[model samples]
Target: MSTTQSDRLRGLLEPLVDAKGLDLEDIELSRAGRRRMLRIVVDSDEGLDLDLCAELSREISDKLDETDVMGEDEYQLEVSSPGADRPLKEHRHYVRAVGRLVKFQLAEGGDLVARIVDVDDEGLDLEVPGVKGRKPTARRIAFTEIAKARVEIEFNRKDKKEEEA
Candidate 1:
């Protein structure tokens, strides 16, 4: 991994994302032979759509190309939304996933699968998405205990209503 190049790109992307009111999920810089790859993942308030990604990709690609940041090579620029299975590391990840199903590993070596109810300064509140006959159970989880947290793509009954509207 080219750490310096990646960091340089991060510096360039941060303000661009903020100015557009979008979150930068991740970035990757790779080179194979004479080709280079610059991938950027993004998310927004209305959720990520193909159109939005394409637009952002074109804009960023143009800017990057102008700067010659990827070096003089045939580079493929790919930009898209973070997949549903993306891990939620930051607090903002949970907030953006309020109506989505998620799975998180506990510090005690256990895991929880539930629908994220909300995210606040304190922590994330997730409601167990109807485990068989069991009703939704809300759990307040702190950041320290979150060993692994990622969005779950499977259908969750609890989030159905929210997704409908």
Candidate 2:
């Protein structure tokens, strides 16, 4: 598939995400039935909330409508946060995920979870635990070996406490 359209969609969404201090996780702008589906998955360093989703959806939809980026046909735009199971890729992906716990299945067939200690154009340097004594070890996984990676939701005490507090 020509990723040009997809890139264009990302270019379109960047402004809104930047304005709100949110990271654009992923975007799939394509045709689904009679309308196009503009799936924007966003997140933040802290996390995501219902309010954020609503705000982004409203603002992004208005901008898209104003710009007419989708051409003549009507389209369905979905602005959502990537949630806990969201994948990690790209420089911005790792940048947003810095200090967050993440899990990924290695190409050789083992899963690892660790805090993202650092990320750069070079690769992902994670603070993973050692298998033996549970020592904190920094493992630099090359971007090529990263078949899959996602933010791991270790716990949601804040979201829960808000329901109580």
- How badly does each model clash, as a count of residue pairs? 0, 0
Model 1 lDDT on a 0 to 1 scale:
0.80
Clashing pairs in 2: none
Q: Estimate, for each residue in 1-165, the C-alpha lDDT of model 1 and write its tens digit.
A: 556877888888777777777988888878878788888988876687777777788778777877856777788888888877888887777887887888889888988888788788878787886768878877888888789988877653455566678
Could you tell me every candidate's TM-score relative to the true structure? 0.84, 0.63
Sliding window of 10 residues with minimal summed lDDT for model 1? 154-163
Worst 10 residues of 2 by lDDT: 154-163
Model 2 regions more than 4 Å off: 1-3, 91-145, 151-165
**Candidate 2 local lDDT, 1-165, one digit each (tens):** 565766876888898998999877788877878988888988777777888889899998888787756788888888777665667767777887777788887887788888887887877888986787877987888777777888887664244357688
**Model 1 off-target regions past 4 Å?**
1-3, 129-132, 156-165
